[model samples]
Target: MARKTKEEAQLTRQQIIDAARAVFHESGVSRSSLDAVARVAGVTRGAVYWHFKDKTELFHAVREEVSSPLLARSHAILDSGDYADPLDAVEAAIVDFFRILEDCPTLRQVLEILILRCEYVDDFVDVKAEVMQPAFEFNERVAAAYRRAAALGTLRPGLEPESAARDTLAFTTGLLHLLLGTRDANGIREQVPAMVSAHLALRRR
Candidate 1:
């Protein structure tokens, strides 16, 4: 009975999270309310409060639901030391992210909320740090990979690891904005592989 109850509770929580993502994506986080999320989830307002204290907490949960798996995959690829070239691992991780983003509607919606829908002012001010934490970690891992590539003499001469990492991050961010702005998943899929390959080629020895 206890196990069943726990499972039900978990399902309810996920429903709320999924509903919150839809609401936030459609309506923007700052303007959205717990009541609206509850309506979308087909649950009571109390159910939302039971799972999350407020809209901010609910937003965090929604973001984490999509971000955690991608971050985990990136960490595994970058930290595994299995690739012959470190930049290959970096490229593979990036390719996997874009592939998943293209295929996963939930990820696309959550990312859209993070990149375009939400504002970082008022109650969301502190939420910015939480959202950016994963990005910082991702940047650091990419920088570490660049450092390893430099040591292997595969990186372009005189290109600092940190600078290369920052450039890669900027390029990826720009592409993401372009993809989300255009809502052109097919177009991005057709273009990004070559663009990413060309970008990485410039950094190669």
Candidate 2:
């Protein structure tokens, strides 16, 4: 009956996103609906429509909300440039990355949306792109680190830096996927350190 202020509108939008995550977690993506999200958020259906064009757009928004902070942390690590060994820096980054993923329950909901919702495939691609941007940037950092290692004579002479970098990237990504799929906290604690060590073994020195 009353026009919502801009701040009220923004708050309502976030509430819907939060509620959507709850519904998604409880019932998976296919079972969740905008109407249900509106009910959970205590907002009218008209308000949800006012903020989002449709479910697809809201799904992307949820992905963005979940990823933006993780990307920012990754970017900060790259920007700070404090660590001497590039692989060491990358390892530190990976630990922090997994910790955030483990701590953020809502991310699990977001992942369910991407992986389970067969009806909205475009969101899957968009999610991949969102993930790839950071992956590419981290790959470049690894490549640079590998080049530096080779230059410092810490690596085998005449080593192919780019190839090593690619291999390291692939290895880390596999390790992360394994970590994400793993439900046991102790198992991850045991596996992640070994994975990091094996990755660092790639260093010549």
Q: Give the alpha-carbon lDDT of every model.
A: 0.90, 0.70
Q: What's the lDDT for residue 128 in model 1?
A: 91
Candidate 2 clash pair list? none
Cα distance off (Å), candidate 1, residue 198: 0.6
TM-score attained by model 1: 0.96
Per-residue CA lDDT of model 2 for 18-109, tens digit only, reads 88777776776657789999999999999899999887677667777877777778656744569666556666776776666667777655
Count backbone overlaps in model 2.
0
Candidate 2 TM-score over all chains jointly: 0.77
- Off by more than 4 A, model 1: none
Model 2 spans > 4 angstroms off: 1-4, 108-131, 155-159, 183-185
lDDT of 1 by residue, 1-205 (tens): 9999999999999999989999999999988999999999999999999989988888889999878988999899987779989998888888878888889998989999999999999988889998988888889999999999999999999999999999999898888888888854676678888888888999999
Q: What is the lDDT of residue 151 in candidate 1?
A: 96
